[model samples]
Target: MTGSHGLAAAQKGVQDSGNPTHFNFFRSALRGRQRVLWCANDPTVCLDREKNPWGGSTCCYQRFCKDTMSDPNHCGACGKTCAYGFVCCNGNCVDIQNDARNCGACFEECPGQSRCFYAMCDYGG
Candidate 1:
């Protein structure tokens, strides 16, 4: 009954208290009720648009994964980070896009004198 939404319900319950059943229902409803934002989703693990920790409040939720594009600690997804000497590229960490050590993928290693370019190992060179 403290919140704005609860006010109306509380007033309605008071008006209907003449009925025994309605009074009992309203009395029980006040026991375990608290204000909560239904659209906040999972506030325990998500951040709002203003980079503030969400506590199920109706503030902002659009910037939840937006930091993943530039954040090394969350490059592609939450808690995903780029390894040493690797840079995030389209959600994956790659090295130079042509490095012999990590040619195409992080685990891909070029053999012999092949020069990697654009994720392709050019053995012709």
Candidate 2:
């Protein structure tokens, strides 16, 4: 009951009030004991208390990600966006290694006679 089993137990315990509910889970000092708190439809609360105890609303999360490493809209920091087909890598948006549009750098297109291979244009037929 330490992984998916624990998650399933929590999910099963959720109540359906149908009014935009939020729940926060806190681990108590007692081993194997967790505190579950349900809040009304409020905008100034976050799942992780350390990050945002009170600020904005759930809409703030719709466009924001707490984890910056992989978020396309906030790669490394808020307001940093990655273009389509590009992924965030180490705080930077980079093209795929074999992408046809951006082979090695931004806007670096592969010629019609060549294809991108591992971020390089390969002309070998």
Candidate 3:
């Protein structure tokens, strides 16, 4: 049997020769026999590290497999985006709000002897 989701099922059991009991058993088993094959070519299919030879696990996003952990366009989840000038860090967008290297803005670093506080560069002690 074949499914629209690219799944194929096949019978898996001992073949019947001429025994009546075996034939009956096989016939009964056949009704509940099914094996599904997971195809790698399917873009909508999600695979784990063991099933996927590329690397780690991946999810289906926009008809493609994406690792949301680092993808800026799909950080943390599918269709999740990072703002402009923000960098994807461990599935979260960084470089904004109290970040010293991007104080008040993207890449707007704090000056010497100063730090970022509340999204602004503070130069006081």
Candidate 4:
């Protein structure tokens, strides 16, 4: 469906509020008469990955908050970010002491102070 953020099931199919029948606050519930349930554990199974604002698809979600690959706020959860400044750390965006990209962000980070370690910064000064 384009995988845009805030794209609720109501938009794609339903014509009512988010109060779908199979919808749940903590789980991936079905929606509309054409109920199709996939894996509830992972968001990707159901929610389509968002495309990058610039173009093409984003490696993660529109807002780091939505991405299932690297979201800490929702860390293995939903609508979450990598915990403040931290990025996805080990299945979640966590503070990385040695991470160049997220080095100082988690510890004592500063611009240019860290270098991206495997995509994250490593701010260890």
How many pairs of residues collide in each model?
A: 0, 0, 0, 23
TM-score of 2: 0.33
Specify the highest-TM-score model's number. Answer: 3
TM-score, predicted candidate 3 vs. hidden true structure: 0.41
**Cα distance off (Å), candidate 2, residue 18:** 21
- Can you list the residue pairs that collide in candidate 1? none
- Model 4, position 44, has a per-residue lDDT of 46
Q: What's the CA RMSD of model 4 in angstroms?
A: 14.7
| TM-score of candidate 4 to 2 decimals | 0.26
Candidate 1: lDDT over CA atoms?
Answer: 0.57
Which stretches of model 3 miss by more than 4 angstroms? 1-45, 53-57, 96-125
By TM-score, rank the candidates, best first.
3, 2, 1, 4
What digit string (tens of lDDT, one per residue) describes model 2 on residues 8-115? 886666633333434422222342232222233432333446545322221234533233455566666655788897776656687767776768765778888678
TM-score of each: 0.29, 0.33, 0.41, 0.26
Candidate number of the best lDDT: 3
Best first by lDDT, ranked: 3, 1, 2, 4
Task: Tell me the tens digit of each residue's lDDT in model 3 across 1-125.
Answer: 45643342222222433445666787668854522224447754556555554334356665556666666787777689899866666677776666887676556788886778777788455
Model 3 is weakest, by summed lDDT over 10 consecutive residues, at 5-14
Residues 4-81 of candidate 1 have per-residue lDDT tens digits of: 889999877767676667657766687434322333455434344353333222222343323444445666666776
